[model samples]
Target: MSTTLASRASSTASRPPVTTVRVALAGCGTVGGALLDLLARHADDLTRRHALRFHVVRILARDASRPRSTAVERALLTTSVAEFLDTPADVVVEAIGGSCTADVLARGALAHGRALVTANKALLRTQGPALAAFGPRLRFEAAVGGGVPIVRLLREGLAGQGVHRVRAVLNGTTNYILSRIERGDPYAAALAAAQRAGFAEADPSRDLQGVDAADKLALLAWLAFGADPSTLEVVTEGLPRDVDAAVRGAARSGRRLRLVATAERAARGVTAHVSPALLHLDDPLAAAVDEENVIQVTSASSGTLTLRGRGAGGAATAAALLADLIHLFQPGTH
Candidate 1:
């Protein structure tokens, strides 16, 4: 009579079981908060579609008292980095902005054999290869182009294809500013508009100075051509101190001024740069205005592939992070 256990399932059960990955997150700002909301809102759909679920174990934030989305549990919040690192989890999601936090999280997550995913291009541009050396469990689809899925396209979609050229408008803040300027606003007014619209950060130096696009381009080169971006010297250029005249001048010639990031594989190596250039009116890049990010890849086998999407804001970036999370954790999925 004691041999039969009521807790046991039937031997003939045929449905696939749901598997879960415990996730420890670092940062809960715009991107991180949105990520929490995304997980909560889509958890059921994910379980139905992928047969997987995420259990958030811990989160590291600068201030535990700060307000966050309703999806984030207060009991899981902590400020100590050590606690975050020590928390038992299958994956670590880092959305902290600065390079310092990114470096620390990447090193710690990889060392622990935990899958790592980040949306920090600045960190990836310099430390990606080193962190990735730990294993193939690293993913950063959110780093390159917000919700564009450019990284997945390079790594999985065109795995063996010979990619020769990659050119893109990778910064949405600068793009938004330029769009305002094209509409006859001065650089100051354009920047102010961007700030008011939440399109630009408070300190827009990195985005306005072209450093952000350079960082993204460097990462793109690493994935597309197997080049070490840290060692590659990317000749960088930003928008003119004032884009009013540049925008007006381009409109007169039926062209458009856009900050473009480019990379080309030469016989010697890969050459990459970020420059503000005038694109012909008919150019697809010219059509990407406001906060649009567009990339065109010319591959030997796949021909030319163009990918474009919303390149700014928390929602778009969070979507990318969710994709990477599923890619790494969903069993039997590539």
Candidate 2:
């Protein structure tokens, strides 16, 4: 097996000259900017390892004049979607987020028969089926897990397995707040810390209200059980009003507070929810600290497969986006 694998790797590396994949990037914010840096820093390694080179042809940003990284060329920045879409490219990566403008870009990309990779869970939760109707050219490995690759696991690694349940810490902001609360920080202080660390936005209502986790859970349901994410109604409950008290209560009982997103497929139907739950210290979910996420998939064949990693931050999300690009355009992947 080792020899065969080595031979296959050698053959793949030796088979071709560099294949350049043109990319049209939407959004040059945190995730998009990090992607540009990743592309620039790892260009040679990506070519050597995968026989693939990435060339960004166009960039879509809200303010084209805003100063950006040196990796970005000023000439490629465009404020108009029409101009961005008109540029020729093999793949369109949408990291601007939200459902309105990002939705338009996603549709435009698929309309032109180009592959779409996005990190926007809100867009996917609402318009997943509509975009998926275009084809499998839609790839969103960054929509849920930041660096965890949970999407790939469900889509390919467990393709035919009987997946029954998915339990995860999908919202890093909530998890970080909870972890801090458990460690004796006040709720306000914990939230402030999360914001300072880039785990929470200044307006963190979506994360605090469980909307972010619910959106991610919906996408996970689509991947694991073939449910339409756009229509899956997740019963979501956010952080408790008296979260500090709840944390103290859980601690007294040797448990920790975690915002847990759960989806279970039953004979009757599928049920999903995002709410704060108490987990014993021994629980795998309890071991996740700060912005770390742990996703556990319970299936008939795979039993319980748990994946853990940094679940938030621009770099982690950017890396996932680049991973999707490599997966979609890598040699022999199709």
Q: What is the lDDT of candidate 2?
A: 0.89
Error of 2 at 18 (Å): 1.0
Positional deviation of residue 86's Cα in model 1 after best superposition, in angstroms: 1.1
The TM-score that candidate 2 achieves is 0.93
Off by over 4 Å in 2: 1-15
- Output the number of the lDDT-best candidate: 2
Q: Lowest-scoring 10 consecutive residues by lDDT in candidate 2?
A: 1-10
- Mind giving the per-residue lDDT tens digits that candidate 1 earns over 1-334? 0111112222225645666778898988878888999999999998878767788899999988887778789999999888999998888999887888779888998888788899988898889899889888888999988889999999989888999999999998999999988877888988888777656778999999999999999998999999998988889989986678788888899899999999999999899999999999888888887888999999999899998888877889999999998887665774
Candidate 1, after superposition: displacement of residue 181 in Å?
Answer: 2.3
- lDDT of candidate 2 over 1-334, digit per residue (tens): 0000111223354466666788999988878988999999999899888887788989999997788889889998999999999988888999998778998899999998788999999999999989999988899989897989999999999989999999999998888999899889999999999998877878999999999999999999999999988888899999999999999999999899899999999998889999989898999999888888899999999799999998988889999999998887776775
Clashes of each: 0, 0
Deviation from truth (RMSD, Å), model 2: 4.8
